[model samples]
Target: MTESDHRAKLFGTDGIRGIANMEPMTVETCVRLGRSAAHVFKDGTHRHRILIGKDTRLSGYMLENALVAGICSMGVDVLLVGPLPTPGIAYVTRSLRADAGIVISASHNSYQDNGIKFFSRDGFKLGDDTEHEIEQLTFTGRIDDIRPTASEVGKATRIDDAGARYIEHVKRSFPNGMTLEGMKIVVDCAHGAAYKVGPWVFKELGAQTINIGVEPNGRNINVGVGSLHPEVAA
Candidate 1:
């Protein structure tokens, strides 16, 4: 499908997302979520690390930084994979042997919408207990107890080239000789994380590609395009 032909999906049960800096997905809420996550993960462990990844939402840069700040205040290190698919973070968390993995994205949502999801050390979503604990921390403002020392403060580092690696992995799922050379495809990335690589993959496979929803303004995501709103795709 051409990028312009895609539609956006809506918010599911797991997280809150909407136009960037608006409604449920504002930067303020993201900061709070970060703090909440830090509190939930703090277990008196002197050493802690969190692996964070995001899709192409324009708001991703803001949210990722806010989340890292929140996590670091509680003394957890953050490793950032600038732009990656949701599943890629899950795999990297297990591979890198980190304490946790966080994804800042609204999968298939438009560029305006964004969200946060976490995975534990075991490579699964955070359990109810952990999520509840974080929620309580967010509401109660009782984070002082979990604060880290100056020396223990966490740092943020970016892992570039993550998208390339992810693309290679995704291509492996197809048949060895399958190619889309003669196909005409339209792709709508919702101007989010998949903006670059999504189209790249189709072109590499030799498809004649048309792209839309690939430009994010931090406010147009999921507004009129993406997987949720299939009208565009149709």
Candidate 2:
């Protein structure tokens, strides 16, 4: 391929995404991207932590594992919050004071599609300069030699309470004294990221919550639900 072809912008406004298990979205690319991001955020004398979250896509397990492997290989510890919403990941990242956060999702895309997005410790998405840096590192292999050894190699852990923490954070945003005490609400999570949290939020607020599109079995996300199909909630 030509240099120009290789130089395509890997990260879009929403992060790097495409058909899952394909080209830029493949396991290899995700791993490289993870390492590249670790390189960019590597700093200071203290331990660095990266947080990862994912939607309900089947391939999320693969991508999440690949990211953990890559980031840990670079000596950056990883916090894995399985099947969480993108926004929640950002919140957790900032709340925990992690160096960075990653979200694995295809958004409104079908199960065969997926993408990766990053957030800074401040909960904001990484900007163009950072994204470009990550892309360059992945494509050029410039930092392949920066690997850390035994004692320095980072670790990964699953944070089972992350979802509850995020839920509590979101609940604090509900208007004070306003409860859905007697209201019937239908939440369509698109069988994607917000499945559990969506209903949980409504119920916690006192709503008679009815949820749809909350079941994701690998290849079913966004099949005919989620924000992509508002009609499903209607």
Q: Which candidate ranks first by lDDT, i.e. highest?
A: 2
TM-score of each: 0.75, 0.96
Best by TM-score, which number? 2
Q: Report RMSD for candidate 2.
A: 1.3
Off by over 4 Å in 1: 1-12, 18-29, 42-46, 56-58, 107-113, 228-234
The TM-score obtained by model 1 is 0.75
Per-residue C-alpha lDDT of model 2 across residues 1-234, encoded as one tens digit per residue: 443554585777788888878777778877888898898888898999999999988889998988898899999999988888989999999888899999999788888888999999899988888888888888886989987999999999889998899999999999897888989999888888888898999899999978898888988888887767788778
Give the distance in Å from residue 232's predicted Cα in candidate 2 to where it truly belongs: 2.7
- The Cα local distance difference test for each model comes to 0.73, 0.87
Task: Provide C-alpha RMSD values for all models, in order.
Answer: 7.8, 1.3
